[model samples]
Target: MNEAWQQALSRVPELLAAHVQISVSALALAMLICLPLAIWAARSPRVAAVTLTIASLIQTIPGLALLALFYPLLLGVSALIGGGISAFGFLPALLALTLYALLPILRNAVTGLTGVDPAAQEAADGLGMTGSQKLYYVEAPLAAPTIMAGIRTAAVWTIGAATLSTTVGQPSLGDLIFAGLQTQNWTLVLAGCLFSAALAISVDLLLGLIERGIRERRRIWAWAGLAMIAAGLLVATLPLMIARDNIVVIGAKGFSEQYILARLIGSRLEEAGYAVRYRDGLGSAVVYQALSEGDVDVYVDYSGTIWTNQMQRSDNLPKAEMLEAIAQWSSHSHGVKMLGALGFENTYAFAVRPEDARAKSLRTLDDLARVSSDFNFGTDVEFLERPEWQMVRDAYPIRFKNARSFSPTFMYPALVSGEVDVISAFSSDGRIAANGLVVLADPKGAVPSYEAILLLAPARAGDQKFVAAINPLIDAITVDNMREANYMVDREGDKKTPRQAARWLNEKLRE
Candidate 1:
């Protein structure tokens, strides 16, 4: 077998663990939520119409957005009740997936409960059985098949949807996919996707067997469900119950810029007496949720990213205005706080190798667009989908006939090798100059600012010692300083160990 397959096989244990939690939790919760509602809906026409309609409507939402939507929503409710609600990671994914899991379960519950034979109901009633007793003893048994089928469907849906949970900072099979995708290793993505699918299929089949056995009056299915779920819960809770201490988890998006910032954060936190852990190479959508959920305590973020991606604000507000708006939004919406800026913006820049640019005379984006049809494009995953790309494309009308994408890792190499002539490089990336790449001028300001800033989880905001201890490092970081930091990992192959990078940065700052 190839090395990719070997790595994929190695992830079986992790994939299995994550799959069990996401599927079981979402299914169990979906059953709990839907069963009662389904029964109630079964009792009346309006109830069935409304509740089922709502559940179905929820199911229609694409998984990722549903997960994203619940982070802030549930966090808001938790905040109103108490001070310790973390909206990120497991909670949001769980809640959204639970909702998604409902349609199958609710529909099944309603069908099962109400589908009982009228003759049986009449006979039970004639025998002087009470409503609860008759329903429990008679209807529940008969409905078991339908109910289990619903659960089977719910389990399948949950397993499939769980892949998206990673976006909310919840770890699962998607970790493999994203990690691999960010590094341009298709083996990783295939491993994650295939494993997750296998998990879902296995679960669906197992549940189907149980449903059949229950329907067929075989006692083994009952024993199996108990065994499977019990085993799953034990495994799922084991990781959490592991001893944790004054551990601070820092996160970063998959790129050079995020690497430097995460390193800086980890370093500062350690110096101030925290045992730091790293959850580096997170996706943009996932990183914020991870922070809100308390999966990650802190990380470096951009004001414009918070403003646009998280808050859905489109205003080209000035730097101060944008930062203030994002800060307020985070506090009220996510129970998170923003530390001030790191004093430099790391915006997107389209660059080509100096040789390639010279040969093509592609100094400006407009000049490059004429030859765009001959070139391929490489950019961060988020940029490929953003409106900024559309705006830039419209302004310049650059039609790269052979457009392609690579993870930030491979982009530099591709550009240098003429595999892709134009790459969406970050301003703070050290690789641009290292590879003698020239950044094209975006005469039209389509892309927004991505100023580096420190974001604090609400739990940490009250600790003045914590805030004051690290606040000084932000302004101390300059563009050149950041570039050098990125170079250590990207070019120097410094293992991308942010903690080490951060300490080196701390010493530099101290000096």
Candidate 2:
């Protein structure tokens, strides 16, 4: 627990900078976007009704779903624009958060502006003031407190929700929370929650001071509030502004194991004197594309994933031959270099709770095939769509009574808790042993070998020093070692951060 806090605290500066950058930027933009519409709507009730309705509709979309939806939508835009936009990271996160921040600000702005005293406006008109002048000098000043209240509410909401940015490759305090949740480290989660709450409370107080100053005509409080806001913004954005140019950007897919491996590789690179950074939570296809396009310098990917998903090959080559083919195909096709396998296979395997498997005598896919309709099948969202699943089904003629897809995080618990009777389990996942699940054998070789292979971008292919730094890890992490490292993070009540687990793996390798 102390170690988890140490790890979480160490990342505070970086994560806090990212969190503020996203939240502040989103709130600022949302204010800019919504305020004008709101002011205009204040003049036109019909327009206000329509615009408010739209903003309310946007707020109804679940936060995580909104963030996920941006990826495919931006990917399409990038395709149309000949590929300049990134589908992940700050852009999508900022855009999604900005949309979420809109309704409150817009609603309050409309209410504040419309609620302004009509007699005040008449007095301003009597002074021969133009419509814009009356709005600026009379209505705006009178309505400042109410509008500022909305902005305050928005600032707090944006800061709290900004934590979700981690899901789309944007780093934030949520990174700690997500890592903690995945690893089951309550200390880390608590730290993130506590810190984020503090930030919200602090910002709300400061903004409240500013609002009170405006309402009461207190110049001292107004100036002090403004100064604090400026100082905060400067502190928040400074780290991002002075970013290093030579950092090696590593990529990882959206999962706990991927997060651990990326951190492990990144820590190793850092020790080797390379400046390292991670662009994690990438979609599988995006990571590969990012690697090929030089957006990412390195990442670990499975040989079978490349062979089938990327290479579009269906033939079941022998393990050695498959690795060779994957290496050759990647190098020739995408300018990707296969460094070497990491000595473990995390292939897709059918798993059932031990008691259920024993009761059914489900020792192999063949056994499951005979009574396929007796159980419900569960799998990660992507598995059912993958070619490997099609191959498995064709080979075994197995079909469960029902099949449901879940996020990787939920799939195992779903299977173990009897929500589903069988699951497509990652063969090397630590959870299999932790939960005491039995993996059914695939004697017919339906699933291909899934060597955890290291890959390099084309430009780095000839950098032997860089290659050598990572090459020693090839074939160093045995299945047991990998599983144990993963378990160190996944096991309940004794979890380690990814870096801690990675460091343990390094120590084992040295021994």
Candidate 3:
């Protein structure tokens, strides 16, 4: 196997275990709540209507939006209750996924219970059986097959939706999928999809066996299927059970640079004798909050991001002054330590195809504004909503004919393909040079300096050995080296995995 496939396969066991853990937990919780509610709803039409309506409404929400909404909601709740909840990881993911699983199980179960034979229920009542006795003795048996069918549907749905939990900092098969999509690593993407699909199909088949057994009065099939599921769950739980001490958790945003930097950090920590875990594909805001909560031990973030997003500052400062102010504010406000800058500024650079720049005589923001009405603007997904974008608009009277968002991975391609005339490109992206694009100047300096910096959680800020191990990386990487490392993974041919890129970058640091 090639290095990419070998690396992708190596991660499957841990990712698959996490996938099974969360999916099964959500399914089990849904069943616990739904089965009892189904029984009660069967007896009362009003209860059935209200409960099923709520579940149906929940189902209408796109799984990704539902998962994103919980992070802020839980954070608000935590503040109101004096703060014990972790809004980032397993809890939010579990709650959202559990709700996603509810509709199918509740709907199917209610249908099954209410559709039970009236004659059998009546006969049980005639025998002096109570409501509970009738339900346990006659109604449940007849409804078993239908109820099992609902569980089967829910199992499949839950497993599929669980892949989205990676966005909220939860580890699942989605990690591979998200990272793969960012770096264009189809091997990783294929592996994640194949494993998740196989898991869902396998669970569906097992549940199908149980449903058949219940309907056909074949108990052995039901027992055998249930046994296999139990065995699988036991195996999934085993890795999670083996505890390790002083493990460091690293966080990364959903992009190739972030992925490479995270692996870079992890490699250093591992050399220092710390067990490392990564939470990749996190949003900008989610990652900072995670560090504040000490859920993440360390990560890289841009100086301007913390200044504008976290501090709510709009006025631009000199790079050195800005970094100092941010360092003080982070320490005072959130107990997070600003370790140091990484010697590169990955600022937002407005770029265009060389032909367009020369033909249109577009040399700067002012020049571009004159022709803005004819061009389409493309940007990374969050840039349109960021304060820097607003600042740029305020400083220059530029409005495009259209604006569209793409993932960081696709933004460059969209510009090159003429789908967009201009893009808010990253200054350190290797594609800017590889594609020979022209970067327009910002004479007014509307955008802030985005010096990449390392940040440590409060707990790790004072660890002498940990600090010593990572301190050399401070101001060690140049923008040229960073871009080269990024291109190693982002290039269409001879692509290296993030780990390989990180190792190469580490060697560069040493040289």
Global CA lDDT computed for model 2: 0.86
**Tens-digit lDDT string for candidate 2 (1-511):** 4666777787787788889989988999999999899889999999999999999999999988898888789989998999889886888899999999999999999999999988987898899999899889988888889999999999998999888888777888887777666666678788889888988998999999999999999979978998998898788668778868777888877666777788888888887889887765667766787687677889999988988888898879899999999898889987899998888899998998899778878899999998888889999888989999989988998978999998766888998889999899988888898899999999999898899999998888888778878887888888887888888877766667788888888777631
What candidate 3 gets wrong by more than 4 Å, as runs, is none
Residue-by-residue lDDT tens digits, candidate 1, 1-511 = 9655675566556555765677677888888888878778878979999998998898788888898788668767887998566676667778888899999989988999999999998999999999789878888889989999988888887888888777666768886676665544566678888888887776777777788888999888777866785775687457555676867777777665675567677666677888775564566766887687677878888876777778776556767777788888898987898878888778778998888778777878888888888788877656778766766776788888676776677778888887777888888887887877899987666566788888887788777868877888767877777777767656544344333455566667632
For model 3, how does the per-residue alpha-carbon lDDT over 1-511 read when each residue is reduced to its tens digit?
8888898888888888889999999999999999999999998999999999999999999999999999999999999999999999898999999999999899988899989888887899899999888888988899999999999999999999999999999899999999999999999999999999999999999999989989999999999999988998788667777796788999999989999999999999899999999899998989999999999999999999998999999999999999999999999998999999999999999999999999999999998899999999999888898999999999999999999999877899999999999999999998999999999999998999999999999999999989988888998999999999999999999998899999999988832
lDDT of candidates 1 onward, in order = 0.76, 0.86, 0.93
In lDDT terms, which candidate is top?
A: 3
Model 2 lDDT-worst window of ten = 502-511
Q: Is candidate 2 or candidate 3 better by lDDT?
A: 3
Q: Candidate 3: global Cα-lDDT?
A: 0.93
Per-candidate TM-score against the hidden true structure:
0.70, 0.90, 0.98
Query: If ranked by lDDT, best first, what sequence of candidates would result?
Result: 3, 2, 1
Candidate 2: give the clashing pairs. none
